[model samples]
Target: MTVFDDGERPRGGGPWPIWGIPLVLSLCGLVMIASLSLRNSMTGGSPYAQIVKQCVFFLSGLVLMFACAFSSLRRFRRWSGLLWFIALLLLVGTLIPGLGVRVGGARRWLDLRLMRFQPLEFLLLAVPLFLADRLDRSRREGFQGFLRPTLMVTLLSILPLLFQPNLGGTILVTLICLMMHVENRGWRYPLMGGAFMVVLFVSLVMIEPYRMRRFLAFWDPWSDPMNKGFQIIQGLVAFCNGRLFGVGIGKGLQEDEYLPAAQTDYIFPAIGEEFGLAGTLFLLSLYAVWTIRAYRIYRRCSNPFLSVLTLGLTMSIIGPMFINIGGVTKLMPLTGIPLPFVSAGGSAMLFMWAKVGILMRINKISLGEGRREREPEGC
Candidate 1:
């Protein structure tokens, strides 16, 4: 029998299960978001307002995803650097006093008339796309050949994220780049990358007082509930309120008044309270299924660009999702990153769905190439 005879046949279209999982997760997230925000919508405006905006972002992301998916990975390789530069421009604009929009204190969003956007969202895609193309291409020369360009590009991508004071995003973006390094150069590069990150994180914590407080709170949040630990305390309260099943959708006490950012960073706690442990577990399982499927896509794709793209996309999805959930549950410190798919943010939803679209498109390539065999050490 041929090598392809092991039930790994070329799919007529893309692998449906890969795309289907995230699509289902997004749909479920939308339903939950609508239900969770129902009271907020009613009190703040119309009951459907948040849902309408989310739908618009979701649809737009779908379009972008498909467009990227069908396009040549070579085309992405050519233009990704330009896209990164554009994102950098937007990031610089965000730092400007009036150009960037400020919600609580961090000026991270740009006021783009119709809607606000966080430039970091674009970096999530652009950086990975560029790195996948460049790193995979560099494998022809040698792993060492990739060192200078990789470091330069990775640093350029990270500087903007760090300056935003978005430690969560910076760590995630760095890891995404490091994943490409692992696929190309192996553990040595990623370990070096990890060591550098440790130093950077140490420096950051030392320089910032609030960051130190968050570290302390991670150790024991209740020590300062009204100050450094208010959010986590409220999150714990929400979890306690959820006994076995849940309080039911739209019936969470956390959203009623107690927890701040209940709809954003603390949304998971609200889910635990309203939907109960069963509901939270159901959602988490979807994410786990999605990650496994994404890695399978990476493993199956023949093209190195497609492989790296899948890995990057997986990190983008899994990293922030786990961190956000962990934070709200007080398993980790409170880092203000949004819950994937479920959080109410236009830029994040649009960018996230667009990446999903790219994954779907790559699956088409994998199927067309016939049952893809395991790629070599260099992605």
Candidate 2:
């Protein structure tokens, strides 16, 4: 189908190029993932361990993407609550000792027999679908409207996220909720909500002295270089090292030893060091294209529920990209957020692909298609 066509109906389940974007992006991720892990993986034990795991996650994600693409949104609506409920169960499970895996400082992952997974990642994707599904149904019948359910869903989703100390994920989830709320309920809710959030945040910050330190450090990391400020300073060093062309892939000095959290929160700095300014721009451009495509899909969606779902998923991806990149660049304070596809984490990659699945599904459903036309068949 042509770009301008108003046909919401998928013609004989025609092809679309949407899938290719994420697929190609995922391949780029594989390359970066391998390179980033080379130093640690080779020396620590197995030479190909991280690469193998990443490949596993990529394969799993590909399966999920297609499954979601062909699956009806209506079916998901019927089951969305259950999916979200399962996600919440996992989140709660993580807080239990022996259940949650602690790496660095946060206890955010659930240790399963097969794999360690971050429940918050699934929550990020599922909560949006759950809210959209419920709100859409409520609006259709014309009750008191989206306000009550929207507020409840937002609170329910975000409360657990915050408690996990996953601030970056919490912010992303909250912003997406706010966006859907505004789109459905109007501007008044967000304005009032924003005011309330500031008051709440200030209270929380006061209760936790570390939060205040983090805030101050975000502004200037050198103020406390040895403690709360270390990550940002290391990130700055990485970028400074790669003034123009970069040190070359897998040749990041920081990744070899200096930079802390090299494979996780500070992954972008490693990218900046190895890929340079030009490569960083190209990475940013990929996200920009993804953002534009996402918005276009949201605009074209006939179902209001799916439109908001698309928007939430898009924001989920864009939010982390910005926070991680900006934090390392010192443009924003350091937030322990992973660089979406490129980061070395199973759960993050899995849910990220799940969001892609949702995006692909929404576009498929919006156009009334059945089979997914892989390889960017051209929307």
Top lDDT model: 1
Q: For residues 1-379, what per-residue lDDT tens digits would candidate 1 score against the true structure?
A: 2211244533343456555766776676677678766676547667787778888887777777778666655556678889888988888888887788876566779988888889988888888888877876674434465465577677888787677777887887888888776765566667787898879988998798878978998788789878777778888888888877888877787546687887678778888888788878888898888776776677676566667777887788788898898888778776788888777778887888778877776676666552253322332
Q: Record all residue pairs in model 1 with backbone atoms less than 3 Å apart, i.e. clashing.
A: none
lDDT of 2 by residue, 249-355 (tens): 88887646678877677777777788888777777887787777776777666556666677777888788888888778878656677888877778888888778
Local distance difference test, each candidate: 0.75, 0.73
Error of 1 at 213 (Å): 2.2
Give the local distance difference test score of model 1. 0.75
Ten contiguous residues with the weakest lDDT in model 2: 370-379
The candidate that wins on TM-score is: 1
Cα error of candidate 2 at position 283, Å: 0.5
Question: How many clashes (backbone N, Cα, C below 3 Å) per candidate?
Answer: 0, 6
**TM-score for each model:** 0.89, 0.88
